[model samples]
Target: MWRVFLCIGLLLAIWLRWRCKNRRLLEMARKIPGPPTIPLFGNALKFMCQPEEFIKVIKDLMIEYGGVFKLWIGPDLNVVVSNPDDIKLLLTNNKTSIKGPQYKYMADVLGGGILSGSGTLWRKHRKIATPNYGRRAIESYTDVFNQEVDLLLDVFNSLPKGRETDIYKYIVQSTSYTVCQTLMGLSKEETMELPHLQYLIDLSPKLYDIVFDRMTKWYLQIDPIFWLTESYTQQKIFKEKLSELSAAVIKHRYKALANSGDKLHLMNSEEDSSKNTQLSVIDRFILSDELDSKELIDETFTVFTSSQEASAKIASFFLMMMAFHPVCQEKLYSEIINVTGKDDKPVTDDDLKRMPYLEMAFKEVLRLFPIGGMLQRTINEDISISSYTIPAGSALVIPIYHIQRDPNLWNDPESFDPERFSLENTKKRPTYCYIPFSLGNMDCLGRYFGAKLVKTIVVRVLRKFKLNSLHNFKNLRTIIAISTTSLDGFHVILDSREKY
Candidate 1:
């Protein structure tokens, strides 16, 4: 009887501890302002709209709550962070390394590859894959980038007069070709031979479309309900097609690697320059035998699909910017001409250094239009800031869009001005204030290659053609999806330019 009495006392102690913990967390959450919540649902209903309308909800919340706010999506508490100092603090913290629960939406598409995976899997994959994308590898791929961009221009040249081509369409294709050759180790002709190449290229964007739909609809996030919906069905179809393509690329690369000798050392300069380079992305993993069949498939999907849109959309944004502000465009043109000396001479890695105006303009474009509007991180431990303490297991919504466009961060934040990114002006802002590709621990793996690819393509295109943009910067309606984009297409008129 005495022992039984002691057990009850211990149980009572555990219950009290739990209760106290819950109260503390509640107080912390209440400190941060947010839209009013309803019981059980919380702020979930506010997000139940179309993907286009999804951006509106975020904008509305930013207007009402300012930078640091909180949202209760069911039982989950998501702290919205737009303040640059808080953003820098969280991104650098080891405890905030895990991607938030929302990353689960891409699990079907990216698998446990570097982009979607967290913890051991992510760290392991990153360790093995980092070397393959090093400086030497990216520089060697410049030839491939130049060739692909020139091919893209050839398509533009063939367009009929007054056609007003959607630059997004052709640029997406060009980007695919660049990724295939540079990273996948597949030549242009080899990628073209795949029966479903075009289908997968077109389907990639639609896959993200479905991802955004499922993400916004809170009910469909549940597996029991989601599996019954059309999205799950469509997701399966997308994966099936993606799997078939992955198999072809994998098999070809495997066979090619098998047939070759080690060739790891830099051979004499007298031989083929390619002979000195390191192995491809898949080659490194295959040689190390660190990843299984399933791991390889996931990594492939992560790298291939993610690479398609990020660079394409940025280039498309610059094209529109060029059209909207021709004076800036001419400045870019003159700089490119002065650096390269001739229209036909390929812009080398060396030439890019002298083209500060081009870099400044691209940076400004990125500032005006970040590819990712928000990034979500899961806090693993209690993090205290100047205003409040963020409890463990809560999600963090880092609003990249609001932070870059905030009135406090930039003068004339709405206007399209390349001068804003001039060396003198760029130094005045916080380092985290202008993260087009993001920065710090979870920084984009493809940033260097992506920048090189876009700059090379822009230079090549500008050398031969002048842009006449059809949209105005002030009135252009933009939306956030897997990528932030113009609600309407990037329509432009390309006129032939005088050659050097």
Candidate 2:
């Protein structure tokens, strides 16, 4: 009887300790304003029921709760902020450099690439990958960009004039081809034949949607529960196929390097001044020996996935903008004509620099529709922002979508105006106010490459065709997958400028 009494006493003590800990957490959460949460489940049910309305719900919360607010996602605390000051604090501070839980889903597809890795691994891989985006490297890729753009123009020329069509299809295909050639040295024909590339093309969207669904629904976040679901089974198969494909590519490249011997070294050798036989980015990765096969595969997949998606979205946005605002299109055409001297002439590196109006228009499109609508970080230490205390381990969400469209930041913020990005007006905004490629040390390494690629394609296309839209801009909707994209498609009518 005495032993039984002792056991009961210990059980009661453990229960009290757990209760005290939870009480402290609850007290901390109550300090910040947010939507009313229920017992046990918190806001999980609401989020799960309307995962597609996530961004809209966030925007609505921002209006009600001000710049900083707390949300209880199950037992975890998520502190969301849209103020530029808070964003600067979260992104620039080294303490918050670690990725949030949402990125865990990406690990299945991306492995431990820089996008998903943290600490020493991220640092080491970033050091090795930085050179691929250097000015000289990107400049060498311009030839490939021009060649791909020419192919895209041929496809455009084939389309019947003045008939509405979804331009996103052609843009994604062309950008995918450009990325494969310049980054992996794969031609369009070869890319189509690769079973792994085909698998990724078919399954990536569904996989992203599943990951996002898991992120919003708290109960589905548990590994055991998620693994039992149909989505997990599908994801497992997709990842296996993707890994096999990546492995094959790595082996093929390794063999090619071995066969070429010293020739491979000379191709990337800085001392060798011949531009005619410059190597592709993959050649540099293979020759450097800084990354092992798995690491190489991860980096390549990261670059491939990120660059292809972002470039396609940016190009599609530019096409949509050109269609809606014909006046801007006319001005852009005049500038292109002035620099190139003829519509038929191919755009050169020097010509890309002379088109300032085109740059402004592109900037405007990014501001309104950034590929990444929100950037996330997991707090590693307690921090204060906007006078609110955010505890360690809480998820920090920086809503770039809301901040960029904030009425307080810009006059008539929703209006499509390219002049808003002019040097004088740009200087007036805060540091973190206009981050399409993100900001801080973790900013997109391929920003310059992506910008150049999109501009090259846009310049080439605009020189040949006039973009016009059949649909209303106000009625258009967007869905955020890995990137923000048109909910429907970017339907536009392309007419040859010669006809105009």
Candidate 3:
């Protein structure tokens, strides 16, 4: 009887503590407007809906609250900022430069890799990784990009002619293969032959699904509550299995390098590779003695998760847009033909640079479906914006999806217009108005590399096929997840350019 009473007392005390925290946070946040909150829950239930529905809920909230508003996820306060001025103020502020505290939740899956890393550790990883992704390095990968694109074309050519197909389906495989080759620095044959390597790659998508689900639902953030769920059980199993596979990879690489008489790159040491671009991402990580075996695995997972999504999903979206807008397709095809000009030569970095319209069309695709969708920042100190004082420790939520689609920001925002991105029009747009790859210190490190790959695939595919859709753009719907994706596949029918 005494034990039962003690348990009840502890439960009640915990509840009261969180209630008081929420009430106190609500008091501070009252200066900023927001959706009404329920006791204990706040706006947590609002996010319990599906990912697509969750995107809509936030869009609705943005409409109701105007520029800046607060949302309470359990006792946590998140201030959603809309306009460009406020976004600049928050992002540029020293307080919010580090990855948001919210991403720490992702650390369970991502570990301390770039996605959730901060401070000295993040800086070190960035320094070593940056050289591998810079323009000179990306320029070096042109051959690999062309190779993957040609393989992608081979897949299309092998298919029966004149049939409606899901181009995104084949695009996924191609992009996945690209990530393994270019980023992981593994051969396709090796990826297929090595079960452990393939398992790690295949396991990521499933883990992302589970992680995103947990991220949206506030209760799932609670360790005790999450432990009770099936998702936790699966993650627990995955965690152990990942440990096993990662060790296997580390062992294999060490043996291969030792046998080849190649030296491992050490932390803070000068890289002696003929060119940093020639070494794959895994090579750089292995070189950086700062990262242990586990950290290597974490970084590898981070790259695969980030790279594969942007490369595949954006390629899908870009191709689908081509099918929907044939005139734009002809315009892009003409540009490609003008650049390459009937020579069976591969596209050069210079060729990619000359095609501004192609760049514009790609930008528009990202604007419609910002891959990150939302950027969250952790506030380190109090900051004043407009009439409200944003307190330190609260999270800042910048909904990129809402900003890009806000009717006031873009003329006929829903209409696909690559012309909007014309150099002349681009200069007239508000600064920071179009940030598909976020802005400021915490921006995506892989944006340039990802964009390069996306453009490369789109250009090569256009050279081989005229993309057409059986479905209209209006029929397309998106589900915002790890990456924004068309709810249904990007259904496309390819007319071989050869037939012309």
Q: Candidate 2: how large is its RMSD?
A: 4.4
* Candidate 1 lDDT over residue span 1-500, tens digit each: 99999998887787567547668677778888888987556799998876667776886788888878899887678999877887788888888888888888988677867887778888888866775566778888978888888789889889875557789989989999888887778878888876577888887777887776666667977889989988788888888877788878888788877677553232223442334355677666566567888788778767777777888988998888888888988899899888886556666899998999888888887887887777788887899876778888689888777677878788888788888887788798887777766666677788888888888888888888888865577778877775788888788888888532
- State TM-scores per candidate: 0.91, 0.89, 0.91
Q: Which wins on lDDT, candidate 2 or candidate 3?
A: 3
Model 1: worst 10 consecutive residues (lDDT sum)? 264-273
Q: List the residue pairs that clash in candidate 1.
A: 323-469
In candidate 1, position 62 carries an lDDT of: 82
Can you rank all candidates by lDDT, best first? 1, 3, 2
Q: Which segments of model 3 are wrong by more than 4 Å?
A: 1-12, 15-26, 196-203, 236-245, 259-275
The most accurate candidate by lDDT is 1
RMSD of 3: 3.0
Model 3 accuracy (lDDT, Cα)? 0.78
